[model samples]
Target: MPADQQRTDLLPADALQGKQLGLSVSESPDLDRLGLLDTHFRMTLGELARTVIIAGGSLFYGGHLQPGGITNFLIEELQRYGRRDRPLKVCLAWTVHRAMTQDQIAEQKDILGLFGEIHFLSPVGDRLDGPVNEATIDDPPAEERSRALTGLRTFMTANTDARIVIGGKRAGFQGSMPGIFEEVLFSLERKQPLYLAGGFGGAALDVIRKMRPEYAEWFPPAHDMPVPDDRFLTALERIEEIVSAVQWDGFENGLSEDENRLLSASYRPSEIAALVGKGMGRLLV
Candidate 1:
């Protein structure tokens, strides 16, 4: 059997036994204020990566072709602890754009060398420029961009066991909250565990406000300029509507066809690590 087929053949329980953890974060500057770049967050994420590796699992992260950010830091940490015997199994989902020059592509390839599995989600055809940050640059029409975004979400969802989203700006125009929201919706529908860390307040905070309003106090004050409740609500409702309108077949990943599973929740980093550790133990035993 082919390698990809062999991977997809594993039962959901067996896949969970591998303890794969996905980390999703915003590239917005607010992440810095949230202390996501600090030693504590790095140490925590590194420790979690180490724990997952030691348990014979893998780590996955997705992002644009940039060098510095939470993704780079995570890559560094994983490389530090990566062992040849166990090999720090890592996967990267890189968003490629038409604007990328040959040099840029080479740089991306060099960076991807650290990962065990690499997946590229690009536009359907050559366009003038790529989607800038969260918005399109000016070339690709809206419909084409939409298709690319959908494909990227589907690919990421099918390839990971669980997801962790952190420090997203509330305003979609300011960051990639729209895409992240869609990913969260997909993961929730697939009955995959989701950890939303909104300590700095952004899209994650907005999600918390909508999904679990009672936990309002748990989130910190909005680090960036505060987005008004009315404005945030409007965007949230729009995303929710999009999610509801879609009829997901739940066949993207090779898990059981049972769609009734409850597999999403909000939690802190420590709590997330603990839950992952517990799940790994149970599945391995």
Candidate 2:
């Protein structure tokens, strides 16, 4: 049976609730704002009973290509609070833009199990079809990964009654969000609250503000500088530090050519630029 089918009790106070705020990234400096990130972090962790779902392919699956240190932080945090007890379910929806070996799949499994179930929505690759241990692998045919976004959007909308948290894997996912903005609007119309996890910038935010004025208040005010005490910002900074350091640091010492290719492909400059902006700042301060 699906996990959703199981009988569930009213969520505890610390569990996730309906109608919460989301974090949109714009500039690298925005991540330094202690005021904004802090509040978002508390809301994320405090609302334990809520389901926190993140989209995008890079953040969760990047470890297959390189030592994506950010993955470890999320695994550690999820392990710290054992999802069975906490109200949170961190869903990592991955697109199989790159191929993986069975051994690679095993590693992903281990990391995913630390939290709730890892659900893989990879377009069916011949390589990834067999006995993977951890994630519930949904291997669609070629080109299906892109199409699956609709199914993904449906899952988000249908599951709104539960204390639901939603985010994307990286900035690119947010860039793509406008393409699926209608789905988002429908979900929000149904009162499904989502967290815009990837970093945002002023220009991109202006686009968003114009796109959805009703939800404009949901975003934190545009700050020329960051707020110092934000927990979510702190977390974001820590994450950026880890990912950035690994990107250029000595972590690539042992990776294969394929692994290196995956790493290189993950950082699509055009996509990232379009998502955040040509002069957009990173989540890292």
Residues 1-285, candidate 1: write the lDDT tens digits.
752343223223233445566665554335565555545445556555655655566666655556766556656765676543332332222234544555665665566465443454555222223233443243555565556666666666776777666545455432223656666776767766555555535565556556555555554555556645464566577545544665432222322212111112222345434444444444333
lDDT of 2 by residue, 120-184 (tens): 44322122234444444446453454444444444444443311112222233322233234243
Model 2: CA > 4 A from native: 1-71, 82-94, 122-145, 160-183, 189-191, 194-208, 211-285
Best by TM-score: 1
The TM-scores of all predictions, comma-separated, are: 0.62, 0.39
| Candidate 2 lDDT | 0.32
Runs off by more than 4 Å, candidate 1: 1-19, 27-44, 84-97, 122-143, 172-177, 220-235, 238-272, 279-285
- Of the candidates shown, which would achieve the greatest lDDT relative to the real structure? 1
Q: List the lowest-lDDT window of 10 residues for candidate 1.
A: 255-264
